[model samples]
Target: MKKSIKISLGGLAFNIEEDAYAILEEYIESLIMHLGNTPEAKDIVGDIEARASELFIDLLSGMQTITIDMVSSVIEILGRPEQIVNGGESNGQSDKKSEEPKSTERRRLYRDGENGIIAGVASGLGIYFNIDSIVFRILFGVLLFANGLGAIVYIVMWIAVPIAVTTRQRMEMRGENINFSNLEKNVKEEFNKVKQNMEKRNVSGFFQKFFNTVGQILIAIGRVFGVIAKVIVVILAVVFISIGLIGLLATTASIFFGSTIVSLFPTFSGVTLAELIGSTFDLGSTLWIVIPLFFVLAIPLLALVFLGLRMVFRFKMRDTVVFVSVATIWIIAVTLLAFVLFFQARSFTIRETVRDKTELILESAQTSTIRLVANANILEGVDIPQKFFNLDDYSIANNNGKPMIMGKPSFFIGKSTSDSFELLILKRSRGATSQLARRSANGLSLLFELQDNSLVVDPFFTLSQGDKWRAQDVEVTLLLPEGKRVYIDRSMEPILSANQTCCMSWPDELVGRIWEMRGNKLVEIR
Candidate 1:
């Protein structure tokens, strides 16, 4: 319950206890009396008061009142007024230096600008942790691979850490005594460091003049190239922003309105664009997939746009809060997207194939030629146009029951070991396991009928309902006996395998032509 008084020192106000105020006031009077009433003396006194005010502020921290102990500590740090002789150290300073106790002030973190290469962060950390700066430098270099985390941390530290400028500050930074002895030693060390740096830079030989000329020329060239580099950077930034914006807009549109837009066209029937995209990869619910995907696409785009704007405007963001928040979110989004992709990848790990072979029934046993015709009525209920159907690998179709995935089957001709003609339908699909793959492959249905010697095959094969797409494919191989002739209908041109027509200049040339199987190869009868 001590009384407190309000006072102003060095234009900074303070609420100090009565005892501390009396001590501080007497100390100021002693400083004024020691150095007479000169302008230089006044300036020195003002500086001392300013330093005392700062010490008081640091001691107070959250407290509102300065105590006698705090005043004593400040006086000790600044030194007693009797120690000054002609505004400098007195001869008695050395005699009393031995009686002064060592300063127990904890080391304060400050950037060591004098011994630093780049902003002094690593050197400051080295001083604080009592380790070599090279270790921190190496750690930062290694962490640069972790999404440039080192650069971010370095920039934040550089912004937040203050450089040690004053002798007292440097002393506190090293946890050294703050008395006159240590202050004087710190000043000498600073002077020696500057002298050494100057000595290294100062050269008086003819080589110095030559090197100076070369340096000047290099600097001049650098200025010219710097402008060009800036222009190139601006151009690149513009390109990045444009690409980011376009990609972001396109992704948003695809997620929300893609199904509506695709419905206008006659490309896919009985399914929306979202369903088609979902069919490609199975990732739980649509929301779970969309949220992570949106962030993964949009965050990078937004970051690119922000970077470009920053570059163009030449503005700086000192507060790292916004940057840190955005970076954290971006990292989370990337991790989630990676997880979703990994989970979906498991669905296609195993591949299984199912095959079916049926003997072709001919009405006439004496018929020597088989005419292969394409059935156009296979897609009777499906509303997709022929041009659109030809372009797609798989599409959804109404199969009079539920919408089913259908794809065109590839056709090839092979030599049969038996005299009778044979047809093989090989269905291939992928799944998470061999069993699931087999199930998916077995669900495929291929339609074909033989009337007399003429064979009609559907161009498309379908997957049963409730089965998702897993790279389902169907191959139709006709095993023909040697010397058996077959005629290909023009409608079958779309389903013919490219390998069978590689020798022909045009794939459609195989249509409407009679081909004879000779020695496991189909030879065109021109």
Candidate 2:
């Protein structure tokens, strides 16, 4: 047994054994010597000693006396000078002033040691906000409704806030200075909790069975959702790949016949057969002849990639770095081959480009309403903002189910003065590749007639984007007045989220295209 000392470190100090004191001094001196007898020794020495002191206390608590080896381990953790000197930025006043504040008086946000789930995030929040932690959790949980949004928010908070451990930190928790010892205590408590949990897992019978059952249930739910997500992703990928492959097949078929004929053609010079073959060799046909063969040869190689991807998924190839490297190389090679094809394909004549100019056959044959077909696949790659829309309030005009008024470009509509105006491609916020073609076609169904001497969109018209029926076109046979028998139905999402263009127009155009759902009084395309 050794006597405790009342030596002060910076400002905070507690008793220590005489032998412990000697060892601490020797360890600090060795650290100073390593840093050299320079002017910056004061700064370096103080940091190393303070860190060493904390380490020493930690070592002593864990069933052994503090040793020089423990101090060296602490030094190793602190590291040395780097591109930016880490610890020398602060001084005596900065640190001492921090310690001067009484514990409870200093305000702080910390992970709570008591009344916490993982760390003390909720407990600390409850303490700071003057509300019960349970209440905050319940509120966010209710808002998220088990959609995992609360979990995301909780995780973000955990990563952001540090746990309060020092006595000063406890005071800071009560609103005080950060206590180093308190901080360490919180950390120790956390590690202990983990240890306890591991012990629980290790124990046999009763509580173990109960916990295992709960864990299994959670894992099952996670797996189910994971499987559903994976399936959807695979389906979407297959659809996209199918589209690409169809193009590849068409390209291959064209070349196959061409190559066969080109190879089998009788090369009889100065003869009737030669003359006939020469006559058939037009520039367009000759080019088409070579292209199909190129596609056929290239198409089979794509299978290698599909096989690689399947192998990666099935065997957990991602667990090994070598597998990842090989997969990456495969991808690069495939990409380069694609580039070559694209270059080779440039010389091939294309009939599709001839028809690239939009064939707009717009006429008001019917008078009820028109339909717009928006090609939303072109807009899928973009990440839409959560709250970029100006949608605030809405009233379902003819929806069949409870309408959702939040997220994305919200729609708002109002009672028509005359009648629901003819649906038209008013204005699109964003899209690519035949952006307004669908809208122009679908929203212009002259199926709407002059109701009360005004052109209106036909009822029951569904405007779909990427196979999602975002809005339906209803024929305006009767006046859709406020509080009328309007039906709003949510089309169960059977595909990836639809990125239909922001269909906002006829705002204040009392008799033009009407979108009352987006809160537009009357939006008209200028």
Full-model lDDT for every candidate: 0.76, 0.41
Worst 10 residues of 2 by lDDT: 351-360
Residue ranges of candidate 2 with Cα displaced over 4 Å = 1-135, 140-189, 192-216, 224-257, 261-311, 314-526
Supply the global lDDT for candidate 1: 0.76
Against the true structure, what is each candidate's TM-score? 0.56, 0.23
RMSD of 2: 25.6
For this target, which candidate reaches the highest TM-score against the unseen true structure?
1
lDDT tens readout by residue for model 1, 478-522: 888889888888999889887763233244877888988888677
Strongest candidate by lDDT? 1
lDDT score of residue 164 within candidate 2: 67
Model 1 alpha-carbon miss at residue 406, Å: 3.0
